[model samples]
Target: MAGRLVLDGGTVVTMDGVRTEYASGHVVVENGRIAAVGPGPAPAVDGAQVVDVRGCVVTPGLVNTHHHLYQWVTRGLAVDATLFEWLTTLYPVWGCIDEETVGAAATAGLGWLARTGCTTTMDHHYVFPADGGDVLGAEVEAARVVGLRFMLTRGSMDLGRSAGGLPPDHVVEGIDQILGATSEAVDRFHDPSADSMLRVGVAPCSPFSVTTQLLTEAASLARDKGVRLHTHLAETLDEDTFCRERFGCGPVDYMASLGWLGDDVWFGHGVHLDDSAIALMAATGTGVAHCPSSNARLGAGIARLRDLKDAGVPVGLGVDGAASNEASSLLEEARHALLFARARGGPQALTVRDALEVATIGGARVLGWDEQIGSLEVGKQGDVAVWRVDTLAHVDIVDRVAALVLGDRPPLELLLVAGEPVVERDRLVRVDEQQVTDASREAGRRLLVKAGVAG
Candidate 1:
């Protein structure tokens, strides 16, 4: 059985239908579901674990649609290179990953995300040393231990440099082995219910790392199991050239050939999608995870986010791989979405509302969980994050919604996942922060040594 709680009297910003925002509002939680939310109190708060967030901005816990949390140990090594070069610079180090390194980095990353007011995150773990033990299970346990909603993508790479792919051969797997392990993990871990805290996605890394047969088979297997599909698509001009030259089609058409366009499908980066790709995604109700910070870091062009959103494609936010983005705060990453889109398309291209929306509900939609965890409403999961208005935009308090967009961040105050507070006063409660930090630092050192990048 779950516990009950009540968050009383805060500025509730429900990015539900119509992008509603209310000042001095009350939200109640019972058994991990938001029992009631409105301007005033209900009968539910009588004996609940009452938390008064008087000066806080209570909003739906932000969602992160894509990340490589273990890549935290690979940061600062892949700089000043395009996507292919960057992958070359880092894959060897990643090929050395073990359960301990993956678990520590993932746990630390999730802890940081929770303290940054993100309660849910989707990790796109594409590294498979084949020798690395239970990479998926390691990350799942890390997320659970860190107390965040976990969508672990059972990702694979079946083609390598020897076979004209990006990753080295040591990191790629046999197609049969990949599919078997993926199917087994889905059966063993994926929960289909609306109330399930954990779900699994089937991802085949990217076009440059896997064969077409593997992509098609992965998509077919994903459809057979009724799970979501994810992959990296069109993040760089080099990738665009690769698609046009190799496949005689763009990324979207190639995906369509694999039966990979639907509401259950989400492609990361999506920086190089053309008008046709945008139309196909919108028509098929496909989702995209926009990696704004990673695009900026890798010198990949900014994604046409406003165009995609305006075209009716479901858009969400992603931190991408830490090796590329190097930063993990999605709320802070939301600011990058605003800045980058504006840098390319001018200020009106993507509004702050749209940026924040992509981080929360839009991300939920991409992950196929909008109905359960995206908004603050009755019968939805009570995953809430309280962002203090006093951070740097005190004057913008007149406009709370604008403050989230334009104001500087106050420290994250309380982060609740299913009505359980995992971060309070910006401190993690699930694991000793010091222990995780020390473990991660050691792992980072080891990752560099494994690559011979450092002694």
Candidate 2:
């Protein structure tokens, strides 16, 4: 089981620089890294585990650039609320969450993501109760149970409603506590090695929910520790107005003034950015995690994905939070990205392959993990997702990539991280799916009761 893994006789869609495709190919994984990927018969090796993926399409495992895994239990809440209203309604409920709820929600959310073919994911969990013990650690435990490569953001929100922020005071942490815990998290959990299964990031919620001081300090700390920075930026017009009135500048200008525009930073839901802001992002190599489904669900305008890509900005896809998206399937999120782009422009706006790229390599780039993941090339991590093309949803598929985007969700036959199977035969291999669901449901009920919400 620790030796080479051969995926034989599948259509390999390598999201390499040239966007190569092999009608019939073999992929070899050894020691958690891709050893070979080429056409025709695979080289036989003694004691290698060969998985016959005939009649399937194999692609680099999807990477989810942004998520709020702790919000998994809050799906369908504030269904009719906009961005601000939704946060206002749910802050109290999220504040009621403790270590147990965080673990359950993360387990369920990460399981859902893994089932949907995501290998690497980033979670922007900014909500933490004043007494919530080891919230980030609980999420890491869940990721270990799900066996997904996780980049857990040590997200902090120091400003509260009393201080003109969206969250309540009890949910926001002190700036000192935030910085100290973030430093500890980076030192304890973040692994800079190429094959690390877990990493940490510093995210200070957003400009509206955090102080300028917290943002600057968090960025500095992240840089000092050699980690990455993330937050929500230009997600809505209200945020733009907040920046204009509060900071006397636009979101992009304020960010740059604080040394936030850099290759090590990525922002979520960049829907309202203008031409100059896009140019800044392109120049600084700052990436965007486009949550098209969540944006549409909350009535936020569609992001200018086409414009961002053409500007040389690294663009990726995210399912966002379960509360906003009401779903956590990265593969389905790709379809939403394609449709949203076409709706923004014409039918030629975002191609199917473009959507796939955003879900795969582009996401890896957004997380600054492109060198280790995102493609089926040799020396990259052996993370792959296998979809059955012979399924009923893809019966008449002429173009495999287009079919993947436009067709119904194909059965995810297998998903592997570091050459180890996490999901196989349409089932999660590491954790009991039913147990995760039950625990999450129970914890959600308790949280709603504690928050005084009748469910």
Please name the candidate that would achieve the greatest lDDT relative to the true structure. Answer: 2
Candidate 2 global lDDT: 0.92
**Every model's TM-score:** 0.97, 0.99
Q: Give the range of the ten consecutive residues with the poorest summed lDDT in model 1.
A: 40-49
- What clash count goes with each model? 1, 0
Which pairs of residues have clashing backbones in candidate 1?
391-410
TM-score of 2: 0.99
**RMSD in angstroms, candidate 2?**
1.0
Worst 10 residues of 2 by lDDT: 125-134
* TM-score, model 1 to reference: 0.97
Off by over 4 Å in 2: none
* Candidate 1 residue runs with Cα over 4 Å from true position: 41-44, 391-397
In model 2, residue pairs whose N, Cα or C atoms come closer than 3 Å (at least 3 residues apart or on different chains), thus clashing, are none
Write candidate 1's Cα lDDT for 1-455 as tens digits.
14777777788988888877778888888888899888854456556777778778899999999899889888888588887898888888888998888988898888888877788899888787756787778888998898888898988998888887788898999999999989998998898887888999999999888999999999999999999999999988888777788899888898898898999999999999889889999999999999888888888888998899899999989888888877677887888889888889996987878888998999999999999998998899989988777654564567776777667766667888988888888899878999999999998898778778899
Candidate 2 displacement at residue 422 in angstroms: 0.8
After superposition of all CA atoms, the RMSD between model 1 and the true structure is 1.6
